[model samples]
Target chain A: MINCKALTKKYGNFVAVNELTFQVQAGEVLGFLGPNGAGKTTTMRILAGFLSPTAGKASVCGFDVETQSTEAKRKIGYLPEGAPSYPEMTSRSFLEFIADSRKISISNRQRRLEEVHELLQLGTVLDQKIDTLSKGFRRRVGLAQAILHDPEVLILDEPTDGLDPNQKHEVRRLINRMSERKIIIISTHLLEEVDAVCNRAIIISDGKILADDSPKNLESKSKFHNAVSVKLLNSMNLNIVDSAINSLPEVASTRIDENNNSLIAFPTKGKTPLEAITKLGAAEGWDFSELHVESGRLDEVFRSITGGTAR
Target chain B: MNGVSAVMRRELRSYFSTPLAYVFIVIFLVLSGWFTFNFGNFYNGGQASLAPFFNYHPWLYLFLVPALSMRLWAEERKTGTIELLLTLPLEMWESVTGKFLASWLFTSMALFLTFPIWITVNYLGDPDNGVILAAYMGSLLMAGGFLAVGSFISATTNNQVIAFILTVVVCFVFLLAGFQPMLSPLVGWVPQTIIDSIASLSFLTHFSSISKGVIDLRDIVYFALLISTFLYANVLVLNMKRGE
Candidate 1:
């Protein structure tokens, strides 16, 4: 387990991370979400034992991060922001260097190397210089080093920030593959990633966490939750669709999406208006192209929850 | 031990990976030859000793050692590898000393390649090879001192150029501290003991003292102290900066 208690960090006068407290249990993949300069990196650095907290404390696997950093760091696999590695070194030598630094014994070294190589798919780029490899390979190389020792706690900062869609999916798969045993915390602004991999998401804006819960629970807080959405064949019928949907007694409000030729009807408290909307559409003989009830709009909740705040 | 050797091995490999290593070695050899024969007049003296060669090493190291040490920590910061390194399960001193040792060994190699000169002098006339060996030891210790100082300055900034310049400036002071011209102005205002202490701290003073065919323990201790003090300072700077 990773425990952080009231962790705070200050850069002279400004507080980069303010009175933050959270714990991560084994088998948990926690996603840290925040705007740029919202203290996500700072908080991760503190947990990785790179920076000391001005107040409170953090520990990894029962070892204190500040006082017993060496012991704590031994069990941590931290991929710092930007996935920094020596550009001059080939990927193979660089991983060997990490293995040597961590003092992985000779008998166990080959197995460890092979494990990470398979986990990160680093075979083709092993001999290539890190400088010439693409961003995706460099990121995987960083991940390879982080997991080289088979550490228990994995802290990755923006692990997929610069990758393409396919590469991002591959990295997510790798994370999920390793999520069964390790305590993984990844910080990113990508909300869908939280929905895809994270069992829990923590959203912070201006150096403080505003919400922490399962992604589904956070999404359920959106105004679009359980809201009925309908797409008509023509945008000219938006007014008719909006008025018809709002007339349903279960609908608390309605919105028109002119761009997509769709209208969304928000359900009243403790009600799902999808069934009522379908009945109403059938009675009026409205030609609907698409209709579904949204669980939530993460983007809308993200904006409303983190929007209009000072950085 | 594992951490130090791993860091040192990687550092050494990085040096060789770039053409900088070969360029530095060639320039060092060529400059040492030019200074010894042209300025010190090795043939004209005809003493059969490598006195001319030994005499110019302090000046030679002033420029070259800083070039080698400038990349020690500065490059790590610039490339953002310092984060990867420090987060590993290694203590601060291990990385610092490991980098220092790698640069020192590289300098030692460049110095060792000058053995043809030593052999040439012996073939020309009968010289005290023991004194020559002692001079080689002194030269290496002085290079180690210069490298230690340069490494400490390297940790202070991310810009290699800035590190190079500041190391040159500080080492220039160490070289000139014992000179009469530099000290004459302070001779009156500064107290006698303070002046003596400053003079004792000069690299030129202890370095030249060992060149007189005597490997004094005090001189060795001076270089050792110089190396350790600056290396410890390097550790302190790293602990404070945390590579920014």
Candidate 2:
């Protein structure tokens, strides 16, 4: 639905987004993952036809952004960063104004307006001026305006930036439900949001697309090492524990938390750590209380890939 | 249905959405009415025309038009909503024309509210309604000219104060071009054609002519061309900034 070819945005000598190319398919939810100022917003702005790229080309729904901007703009709904809205306008009036500007028919306008209001849960606040609404409510109002005409693609830049936890979840749910029909690309610093809403994640850093894959695949690739946590019921001699585990061929390294009576182990090649763990437990006759294994988390994958803290 | 009308409708709605619209109207009416009664000596202009009312318009619009147009683009930039607006499907000229017309129409409404002065003159004297209508047209044209200049100045910056100040400076230059005392020093050396051109560009020259019940094609074309030029420039400015 959206395609970018070596798109680069430069503000004088500073490059905001550099030579980036990617494509999002129809009905795909692409998460634009980046640290702050990593050119996610810049790239999204260019695609939304707000800012022109200093070099290269971008298109939305088959129309070039620079040449066919109006046609491209007509095909997309953009929720800009901070979800800016006319503070003096009521939610209903704002949506109606957008609908009119988009030239939606009166019969369909009412139905679409109703759909947005219900979808964003803006019914109660529809009559209230946007200035009087909270940040979350105001953001929802922006979302309502974006989706009122139901464009083919939705480009949301930090859709849930300043929302409470519950509101964020609500927005995530709405995005997921909307994703069934429209191609949605969201740029956010919050990794959990991408995990919850996006099936495909694109990690960008320094204006470059560092990684692009499914969330599960990214997790597995970055998380080749598994961390197993264990707590023992009784005191265990540290040297004996380490000697036993280190001697095992499957065990690469062993660290013992004598205070908590736990063993943290890394696996060796061509063998599973579980085998070593089971063998050590059987031979040492050690009393164990808890053991749990977790797959690599999104934060680890993101940090390892982006080479910086997720800001 | 047209792009210009769509933008105009939204702009007009926005004016009422805040205190800005009401504030400008009240200030415009009170000032114009006060000037008409006390300063212009409406009781003794000794003629049957809206002379006193039309006379103060150039000065009134000097301040009022800036106040109205300063926020046209500056506020959009300040709030970052300009990004959303410029990306809309409408052409830049359509939005500019729409916004300019809305402000001009609102200014005309404020100007028209002084009709009671025309009524009072007709009630008390043998006033020519045709001349009065012509004066209103002239005042509107002059107001449009000032608004166009203001719109152009507003597009230059994101600060409303800067927009207002710059627009006033530009309008002042236009006003000074025709002031007899202000331009008298240069009259000796400059050729009459150049002097006439300078005078013709002044608000007082064309507007005063129209106020005398004369709708000269030159003056009418002057106002329309001036407004269109500035609006075209406004669109270019938006495109240039967006294209960057």
Candidate 3:
């Protein structure tokens, strides 16, 4: 579990993290989303006990990050941005050193190392210097170190940033698999990553929390939610189909996508255009090739929430 | 304590894993040998004591110790491993002490390898082995003091080059603080007590006293205090870094 209250971090005249607060419970994969300079990494660092907040307090698993840093840190597995590691040391030794630092019992240390190495597929590069590994492999090594101790809370900053699609998918799956027992907080700019792995998402911008909810809830805020689009067959006229769909009580408006020869209908509040459209189609003998309704678009919601700024 | 040993072990391993450790030891031995035989005129002195060898340590460590200490914290910061290290469940003092001990142990190893010089001196003539042993202890303590200062400065910057230069400049001041040429100019302008206090802080002064084989409590305390002071500063700097 992670709790942050009015956590603010400032560097001289600039405030990196404003008076922001949020809580994450165990077994929750919370996606931390923000544009660049939005205090996402700063927040993660504070929570990881790497940086102390200039104001307010943050705790991981109920231990205060500042006053009780060592205890707080004991419960956290942190992957800093860029996945920085000692370049000269082999990956295996590096993880072992981390295991030792984490105070893993000597009996369990070797077992934990083997388990993480196998999980991250680091066998091939175990004895190789970390500097020689590819970026994806290096990122995996960082991931392995974070999960080595299997701490109660995992604070990963951009965990899947440098990984390939497959590696990213594997990492997401790993996070998902581990999500049932630990408090996982992943800070990422990737919208699709949230959709793929996160059960809840928090969107922050300019050091402030703009939105916090489930990924589905955030998507439902998009304009496309509950909207319907139908592709007309060559036999049907676009105007007739559009006007007929638009005339329905549930239909708010209709627009024709001329390039695709499709009719898109917008529904009014608490309305379903699917049943009305099906009835109209059956009665008028309107030929349609495809029909579907959109749950929502995450990118649209993210762009709107983050003010369309590139992170 | 476990955190400290973990960091110490990793640091020691890192030193040996790369070519840096070998290169450092080789350079240290060669330079000390050259200084003792050539500059200090070990063969010409006709004395059986290791005076010529220990005399050059203050100057030798000025450059060599900084080279060793510069990478202690600067490399971690440059490589961004500082984040990984600090975020672990280790205290700031634990890591600082751990890293300092590793560098000190490596320096001690290099100092130990110069045992052949001691053996040669004993082989050629009957040297005062007691005095020689005391001088070795004094030299290592002085090296620890220099390393502590260098390590503290290294933690303040990310660039090893900058750390080395700053350490050299600071250590040079400490080395020259008691020297006549440096003190002569300040004698007329400053008070005699102030000059005496400044000279008392010099590494050369305490090291010279210890090298004489007396091993006074004051000299030992001087090096201890200097080392603890610098290491305390190292811990404070890291704490400040965490705040930043």
- Give me the candidate number with maximum TM-score: 1
Evaluated at residue B43, the lDDT of candidate 1 is 91
For candidate 1, lDDT tens digit of each residue in B83-113? 8998999888998988999999999999999
All-Cα superposition RMSD per candidate: 1.8, 2.5, 2.1
Which of candidates 1 and 3 reaches a greater DockQ? 3
What are the per-residue Cα lDDT tens digits for candidate 3 across A115-217?
9989999999999999999999999999999999999999999999988999999999999999999999999988999999999999888899999999999
TM-score of chain B of 1: 0.97
Ranking by TM-score: 1, 3, 2
* Better model by DockQ: candidate 2 vs candidate 3: 3
State the TM-score of the second chain for every model: 0.97, 0.94, 0.97
Candidate 3 chain A TM is 0.94
Residue A217 in model 2: lDDT: 79
Query: For residue A182, what is the lDDT in candidate 3?
Result: 95
Per-residue lDDT of candidate 2, residues A50-122 (tens digit): 8888999999999999999989988989999988887787888878778877888878988888888888888
Best by lDDT: 3
Model 3's i-RMS, to one decimal, reads 1.3
Among the numbered candidates, top DockQ falls to 3
In the order shown, the candidates' DockQ scores are: 0.66, 0.68, 0.78
lDDT of 1 by residue, A105-132 (tens): 9998999999899888899999988999
- Which tens-of-lDDT digit does each residue in B59-173 have in candidate 2? 9988889989999999988998787677667778888988999999898888777778777888988988888888899899989999999998898899999999999989988
* Lowest lDDT block of 10, candidate 3 chain A: A302-311
